[model samples]
Target: MSIAVITGASSGMGEEFARRLIAEKDGFPGAPFDEIWLIARSEEKLTSLSEELDPKRCRVVPLDLTSADGIARLSSLLSEKAPQVGLLINSAGMGKAGAFASQSLKDVESTVTLNCTALSEVTHVVLPYMTSYGDTLPKKNGPRIINIASSAGFLPQPDFALYAATKSFVITLSRALNQEVKPHNVTVTCVCPGPCDTNFIKVSKNDPNATFTGFKAKFVTTVDKLIPASLRAAKKGRSMLVFGFGQKMLHLASKILPTNLILFFERNMK
Candidate 1:
């Protein structure tokens, strides 16, 4: 059976993707997935989400990718089922906003663990399943991997140091991995979206009211808009997707301008 595995499926962009994929299954390049595996730590939320969709088609595998035990459970399930993985979306990530020195070791470790290590581990496990089918399926419709990175990855932020650095790792990894898997007809699309109105901000800042500031706030995109655009870009085999005009510009500027110049402006803007 062919399946689409989505991490962080309980909320945010991940939840949006799950709903849309089921709602418009035929529209996606790789249509007719037999099952959609929803991976997250919240069993309650995952169960509720599954009930809302086609329960028969939606399999809720509540596993915290950040934990080794959780990842082991996923790996074992994959081995047991041996289903063909048509798509994989790594959307489980977190960030704490503060000075690097001031942040607790736990928060810093969790950010790096979820954003970088877990993502890489999940991808490594699912990649074999995807690559195995690449030769038979057309490149356009072959297995796809979407990594939900952030616009913050483009530059280093003073207050959000660890988060930005980890996202940068995602961007770099996804790009190179895309090239490595291209020969196998598997495409990896890294999505770098600006701040969105989601639980992510509340968690990041540890305050409900905290959110983007200045121009960053102006370009914030919704999950409703971001997910569809990202899926479309991935289907088209694009290596990177920046959702908003502001974010697209930031991505370009990061490439053209020197790092010190960008950092100078970033420091002054705050």
Candidate 2:
């Protein structure tokens, strides 16, 4: 069976991606996804989403990817079934906004594990199962991978130091992995979306009053706007996608702006 595996599918962009895939299957010609493996930490939310989707096509795997056992479980399943991976969305991540010095060791470690380690492990395990190889160069086809990196990945953010650094790793991995998998006809896209109207703020434990301030406030993207744009960019086999015109301009700025100058401005903003 062919399948699309999405992490962080309980809420936010991951959940929206699942919904859009089912709704837009006809939009993608030759889409062969007969099943969707929804992986998330929340069993309740996963159960609810499964009920909403086609029961026969949706399989909920409620496991915390940060845990070694959870990662092993998914790896075993993939090895056993060896399903054709049509798409893989590495959207599972966590962050907390605060001074790095003041953060708990647990919180810092969790952020690094979930945002970077787990994502890398999942992608590595799934690559062998993707049905992207062919006799000819595959154009606009899967298996495809989308890693949900943050706009913060582009620059240093003082209050969000750990999160920003982890996302940077994600962006780098996505770009490099794209080249590595290209010969196999696989496409990897890194999505850099700004703040969105999602529960991420709460999940990240951002201070309510200071959550979206300064330039970040102006470029807050909605799930409705962000997911489709990301999906479209990935389908086109783009290496990186920064959502919204404002965010796009920001990405460009990161490339042109001097490192010290950008750091100075971000430090003042925080």
Candidate 3:
């Protein structure tokens, strides 16, 4: 079956994407990409989601995108299944909660592995099938790519420095790739969401001083709000979507103000 592959599918936006696609079978408005291949590192959870979502159209592939073997295994899976990967969502990433100087080398490495290495590796391996002329994929009506970036991408977070860097990497990479594929009718939209309930805060927060304000204004955002907005931007092929009024304002501010000033507040605000 034709498909849209999404990483980090165990929970949060990843899981929501699967459910939303299944719930709305017609695909996102102007951009329609049917089927979804869910990827995550948990077998039990993937299996459960697959069953619960009525896998009539969804396929759960428990994948750890951070390893070479994982990529090899997925490449093999794609070869056999050869589902037309119409959409690729690089939603899998991790963050560390410490100043750059305080975080352990291993913590830094792991964060980079998931947030940068794995996502890029998946895109690297999968792009051939999705963009290549191979029998390995079913015919793609139109292909689209969406990377789950963060409003953190717009500025550097000194406390969460590494994580902020990774998000910036995602935002830049998505824009660069979008330029390459526009000629072939493919769309790439980077979603810079402020915050919603997600395990990221739990895993990334280790200190009492760790603060999340501007981007993750706890008072306003909810996953219920983010998912729909992202889908709408993806449908219209928006190059970048800074969700939430706060994030939109931040994006606009970045244009008029020096980045250093914008970053000053991002790293120091309440």
Q: How are the candidates ranked when ordered by TM-score, highest leading?
A: 1, 2, 3
138-157 in candidate 1: lDDT tens per residue? Answer: 65677889999999999988
Please give the range of 10 consecutive residues that has the lowest summed lDDT in model 1. 23-32
Candidate number with greatest lDDT: 1
After superposing candidate 2, which stretches have Cα over 4 Å from the reference? Answer: 26-32, 131-140, 206-211
lDDT of 1 at 162: 91
> Any residue pairs clashing in model 1, and if so which?
none
What is the total number of backbone clashes in candidate 1?
0
Q: Which scores greater on lDDT, model 2 or model 3?
A: 2
Question: Model 3: residues >4 Å from true position, as ranges?
Answer: 28-35, 132-141, 206-215, 218-220, 266-270
Model 3 Cα lDDT, one tens digit per residue, 167-270: 99999999998888776567789999876676666667854444455545553576677887777777677889888787888778867998888767765764
What TM-score does candidate 2 get on C-alpha atoms? 0.93
lDDT of each: 0.89, 0.83, 0.76
Report the Cα lDDT for residue 174, model 2: 88
RMSD of each: 1.3, 2.1, 3.7
Q: State in Å the error of residue 79, model 1.
A: 0.5
